[model samples]
Target: MLEEKGIKPAVVAGLSLGEYSAFVKANVLSFKEAVQLVKKRGQYMTDAVPLGKGAMSAIMGLDRQTIKDACEEASILGVVSPANYNMPGQIAIAGIKEAVEKAGEILLEKGAKRVVPLQVSGPFHTQLLEPASIQLKEAITAISVHEPTLPVVSNTIAEVFKDKEQIKDMMVKQVMSPVYWEDSVRTMIDLGVDTFIEVGPGKTLSSFIKKIDKTVTILNVENEKTLEKTMKKLAELEA
Candidate 1:
């Protein structure tokens, strides 16, 4: 659809599961391979933590270092660490249910405006998911990956993938590493990206981009109405 409208992005990046989409767009993984890999990855992650044992929570209105410290302090209870550095004040922490709850309390006491628990299957992007990461590495190694036609920023490294090997390695590490979303967005901005079009079912990425840099144009295409609106906006920008 974007090609039909004569729109091409200079760079591409994705968050969490969205990274697979970026890989597909960059021609690094075929649709079939991506689907198969994701299926296995999902199963591995699900199996990594027992049901009711893991949890995740969103901490808002707190700086990154404070949240990190809270997680470290909560580590005594069990595994707990920052998961997604979504934006300036919004971050997610994941780990054992007890540790996550403990960290949330600490975050609140440390001046966080709000801490909401997230309903997720496992404690992702933390050491607890190391088993999943190992499984994902084997799964990824079984598949063939190609160098992207355009640079694709990595959530784990907050930088463009250097080569196909790095892409494979990062895909594995990303399973157990915090998503450096803000850094990735800033990197794109530094590379002169003024317009960001999120092509997915949700507006989460668009919202994050808006919070990251309000000066940049943000658009999302989830349905026909949004697609038309985005097309008109793009036309205006091009004109």
Candidate 2:
């Protein structure tokens, strides 16, 4: 649909599960293959840890170092680490349920505004997901990937997919690594991507981009209404 309207992105990226969409957009993977692989990937992640044993929480109004220190202090109980560096003040931490709770308490004492638990299946993007990442590596080994026509930013390393050979390795690492969303956005802005069009549902990424850099134009295409609005906005920008 975007192609039919003569709009082509200079670079592409997405957050966590959305990274698969970025691979498809950059021609690194086909849509069909990504869909099929994701099913097995989901199973691997689920199998990595038992339900109710893991937890994630969002700590608001705290800097990264403070949160890191809190997580470190709480790690003696169990594995705990910062998962997603979403924006400046909002960061998600994940690990064993008890450890996450412990870290939340520490952060609270250290002046964090609030700690909100997230409703997710497992403690993703943490060392706890290493088993899942190993299984994911083997799963992607059979599939063939190609060099992307355009740059595709990665979550693990807030940088473009420069090496096709390392794509699988990066995917393996991505499963158990923090998503550098803030750095990734800065990388895109450095690459001269001033306008961001989120082609799928939700305004989450759009909101994140706005917080990162209010100077950029952000749009989303979910339902027909949003699609038409995005198209008209793109036309105006091109003019």
Model 1 clash pairs? none
Error of 1 at 228 (Å): 1.0
Any idea how many clashes model 2 has?
0
Q: Please give the lDDT score for candidate 1.
A: 0.93
Give the 10-residue window scoring lowest on summed lDDT in candidate 1: 1-10
Please, what are the lDDT tens digits per residue for candidate 1 over residues 70-110? 99999999999999999989999999999999999999999
> TM-score of each candidate?
0.98, 0.98
Residue range 82-172, candidate 2, lDDT tens digits:
9999988999999999999999999999999999999999999999999999999898987878888889999889988877777788988
Off by over 4 Å in 2: none
Residue 14 lDDT in candidate 1: 92
The global C-alpha lDDT for each of the candidates, from Candidate 1 onward, is 0.93, 0.92
